[model samples]
Target: MPRANEPGRTVSSRLWDLLFAFDPNNTELTLADLVRRTGMPHATARRLTLELVEAGALERTSDNRFAIGLPLWRLGTLAPRAETLRRAAQPFVEDLYTALRQHVQLAVLQGDQAVIIERLSAVNAVGLTSQIGGQLPLHCSGVGKVLLSHSTPAFIDDVLAGRLRRFTPRTIVDPAELRGQLASCRSTGTVVVKEELSEGAESVATRIVDGRGKVVAALSVVVAAGSIKLQAAVPSLVASGLGLSRSLGWRPGIPIRTS
Candidate 1:
């Protein structure tokens, strides 16, 4: 049965509904889950899902659940912003990973969340709650804090007034404490977070800016909590971030020195 008083939706809207049903927390879905999420009639839901599967927009798992397919992922890489940023940032990200031998990540702010655009993983790195295409919180993540430091005051206020999930005990929840942290990050252009998002993980991150001084991205290195000193990693992470920013036309201090 169609949902009670469900707004009349077009085919394009329905397609968007099905495609967007897959998110960070809901990556794979059973038919019932899709039907429930989309609130479509069972027959219409199954038909559209099958169409998506046949069109290679989505794939069926071994357990008969559906997930975003390789074809869609390939298509997503062609998006101008994501692909270009991935290309421009890969070398710096690689250098950071090689220097630190830990999990290195590149992220960009998408609305209030930091979207992981790319990552380099080490075999024995600490366990992570996030992966490529995953979202990070604005309060507790190093990259998230860096991005938040540059965000508009309105955005920061809105996020602070909403839910601030505490993944670990160190996660920043107090708005006043977080305000001070943001101020410090804005001044230093970097943040070192200790197990704020995930237990057993720590990160040091800095901002990547463009010619206009607009922070376009964030770079970070994730290492095991207490395995090595955060100070040891901060220099390299900051240098790599500045190098990447310079490549994108950000000049730190002094006026327009040869870009």
Candidate 2:
């Protein structure tokens, strides 16, 4: 296999390597940080970094670190999956946030993880590290479970057979138990998670289907554990999910398709 800095690597690939080094956790980085993260030589890293800054793909912070620029974010908004789903689910997500005064999020499956596309959060709600672009574990998170349940059987099997990380003691790591949970999730179109992903956090999630009844995304409401009655939020959460699904052309009697 070729190394990242091998002579065969293209310039565009090197540039992308630098950009990809910045993520939800490492959102800002210094030139040295980029060099180490991308495994590029200091001079080459600096040159590409400067070029990206000139091209408005990255911006320098007051502390002399680099972060993704506005133009780059604007370009990401053009992606059909994130923008279309976010726009269609905005109103319903807002209503849920207002009613529950908790964290309301919309997420879609991306590979083995669930990526949060949009989120509305309350000031006093549970302190969560994940943001709009952050990812959640498929085997533990409420939205993750909903999306995973509606995924293809082969894909679901791969996830269940893989190493499931135990975030909390309550996290269901056993494949047999999780299989049961996914079965229930598919039958009911929703799942309730209690402190599986994070201690003192609980969530309830429902699938968001499209016109063809393909589960396109998952909508979830997360609250501090024991802060509010989870059951009370279920009706509103499912209703908002259905309302968003309807906006996407889904209707009654359409058989849900596994993606």
Best-matching candidate per lDDT: 2
Best by TM-score: 2
**How does model 1 fare in lDDT?**
0.85
Query: What's the lDDT for candidate 2?
Result: 0.94
lDDT of 1 by residue, 1-259 (tens): 4442267777767776889888889989999999888878888888888999998899999999999999988899897657888898989999988887888988888888899998999888887868888888878899999888888888888989999988888888999999999889887888889888888888999988887888878899999998765778899998998888888877766232111
The TM-scores, one per candidate, come to 0.86, 0.94
The segments of candidate 2 whose C-alpha lies over 4 angstroms from its true place after superposition are 1-3
Question: Global lDDT of each model?
Answer: 0.85, 0.94
In model 2, what is the error at residue 75, expressed in angstroms? Answer: 0.9
Residue 65 lDDT in candidate 2 = 100
Off by over 4 Å in 1: 1-5, 23-33, 51-56, 59-67, 253-259
Give lDDT tens digits, candidate 2, residues 61-175.
9999999999999999999989988988989999998899989999999999999999999998889989998999999999999999999999999999999999999999999
